[model samples]
Target: MVSVALAKPLDPCESPAPFSLLVPVYRGDSAHRVRRAIDSNTHEQTRPPAQVVIVRDGPVPQEITDELDRISAASAVPVVRVELEHNAGLTNALNTGLLWCSHDVVARADADDISYPDRFERQLPLIEAGADLVGASMHEIGDDETTPLALRQAPVGRSEIARVAKRRNPISHPSVVFRRSAVEAVGGYEHVPMAEDYWLWARMLHAGADVRNVSEPLVGYRVSAGSYERRGGPRVFLAEMALQWKLRRLGYVGFIQWATNVIVRGGYRFVPLKARETAYRFMVGHRNS
Candidate 1:
């Protein structure tokens, strides 16, 4: 969905709008996946990111170190690695990378997720059209895209995004390209665990950013049926509840919205894995099934 605000003709820019991609990695198991993710961005796109910043969350295994080394050694575009002394989480890693990035626009790539070659190309226009933040739908794949799970959908347009923001995240975290100044204006990313993206989106929206989503799937989001189960637990629920109250304090959530978020999301955390699978399909987004 094009932002209705940008429905008018797209005036060509004097020069290309350059952007950069950022990926955060922790360990060896993710190295191969990270390579594929980077390949999708650089190998065939008409307009690839100017830089790919991979932040080493901590001391990764030698295999991961080797893989990053080899890729950086051969890439045509800059594949810069920022190594951390110890394991800081995703939020910190991203925050670190953001400070190192050069462009005003930044796209995030999960080390384990795959991007379509044109993902960056497709997102630049929305940002150029005054979107501070833009994301798109993704094919939620477990093993492969064939017979996959769901197409994770995000709300489109500013008003719809604000309405959905009161209850849940209206943007896909990994599949986002946001204006650096807009994000920094809202305090960059907080150190919120499990729900950093949710917290950041709410805060950014409250700070009056124009957020929108394209309707098409541009990313292959890796989603095992059991992922919802593993990614949810007592700690995650606690973090989520904390986030609810945080949003409430930020005026992005009301008392009822906060309570409902705590109850509904916390309850979902306790369901069996099979039931969690169904909840993942139902709650995550619109279903083509």
Candidate 2:
């Protein structure tokens, strides 16, 4: 079993309030990747995070625990680990971190994602700008770690974000920073299985929280065929379509609607890869025009 520690409770008058970065770890994750994330926060050129709350689900290997201990010792920032007796999934792990966090701001990081040097620096202002949530663009990095594929940018500003979010998920979860109060107000993370981030955003928006997106890429999101396929492929796509149907009832027409239209118009035979490409080209051309 891994060692666990609950952060000490704090009063409301604490000076230089810190930001809590919640990281959830599961089995099969590379120790080197975890170390890199810790190092990135410690060596941050801008404002470094005050604390990193890592939740290790289930009984991790001894080697991984040791590596975490070593990294925590060398870290300039406070690193706290929470151990669970059994794997309760991402939503539960994040809830553990949320309970342990004592800061006003909460930031999220995934084990596989790499944060740019100025990620925290760039997000701090937006968080202070009275926005409930802020996320930045991400550069999709290939497996070789050197090749960059595409850049994803989320819409910024409350109104623009609402317009775009109505169409699709405009913000990336791993690159998001938001107020703790806003998250709590929305009832925190939900057990949405594969679409946890999307569910959380929908709930937050429903609760009247303002969301924004930064125009700059501040993180590298590793994307692979395997990862994409595991996200439920056709089942996931259909699930999203159902979710969007619900959203439309709430007066939001999502991107899935457009995709579904293309799939239906092009016939199911072309629905797999080629139709997707065609739809992408049409959307890009429309956006540019």
Candidate 3:
């Protein structure tokens, strides 16, 4: 078992160290899943987290709040809950959490995600090694335990990530760990209604930040089947395309590559449910890609 001895309480006014993990939660998510993600890190063998800030967009159920309270009591790591008076969108909630980050490095977590035990243990060293941003491969999980979903790996190295970021988001937002200075230098997370993380990555690259990827699966991204189908529809694709075009206008990459990759990757939508599940199985089990 990994030890949690190094974990410590967070001081709001000053960063105790160089890294803090931030997770933003909307009211409707499954509290159990959120607790799982939080527990994974708090129990891991890691450099003591300066804080694990969970920013809530609005009021949550009593049960969920109680769960948070229980997690706080059981874990040595400080779990700070920041509640908003009203429901704000993801971008605003994330920025709110960012303001509370008291560390030079910031890691992101999603409410429904399950991070591997070594997720931070692996990424933090890379940040200390001087990479401005680092992300790892992700394994997708679904509601049905019998089937898997998509497994993705991003390019490694700052130059490669920069090249990929020009066309598409090479890193998974939930799996990314970045330098607070680099993010703040880029003016923080923009209020893009969609693809906010992609937009921020492009902005960071334009500002000359180094980004890289660890070649290991460090997270299990839950894709609620119904949610995926809805979000992966044409409207979101078009919105993403528009965001990519905005990146092009900024001179990060040409429109052709972005368009081509979008079309090619978009073809995955045509995959039948069973085929998609099969592909995920192969991707998850296959070591080398």
Highest lDDT scorer: 1
Query: In model 3, what is the error at residue 148, expressed in angstroms?
Result: 5.9
- After best superposition, candidate 3 residue 85: deviation in angstroms? 1.4
Q: Give the runs in model 2 whose Cα sits over 4 Å from its true position.
A: 1-17, 143-147, 231-234, 245-270, 273-289
Residue 72 of model 1 has an lDDT of: 94
Residue 280 alpha-carbon offset, candidate 3, angstroms: 11
Q: Assess every candidate by TM-score.
A: 0.91, 0.80, 0.80
- lDDT, candidate 2, residue 96? 81
lDDT of 1 by residue, 5-63 (tens): 22222368556577888989997446777777778777656678889898999898888
lDDT of 1 at 26: 91
Highest TM-score: give the candidate number.
1
Candidate 2 structure quality by residue, lDDT tens digits, 104-142: 788898877788889988887666656678898877776
Clash number for each model: 0, 1, 0
lDDT of 2 at 265: 30
Question: Model 3, which residues run further than 4 Å from truth?
Answer: 1-18, 143-150, 258-289
Q: lDDT value for candidate 2?
A: 0.70
Ranking of all predicted structures according to TM-score, beginning with the best and ending with the worst = 1, 3, 2
The C-alpha lDDT values of all candidates are 0.80, 0.70, 0.72
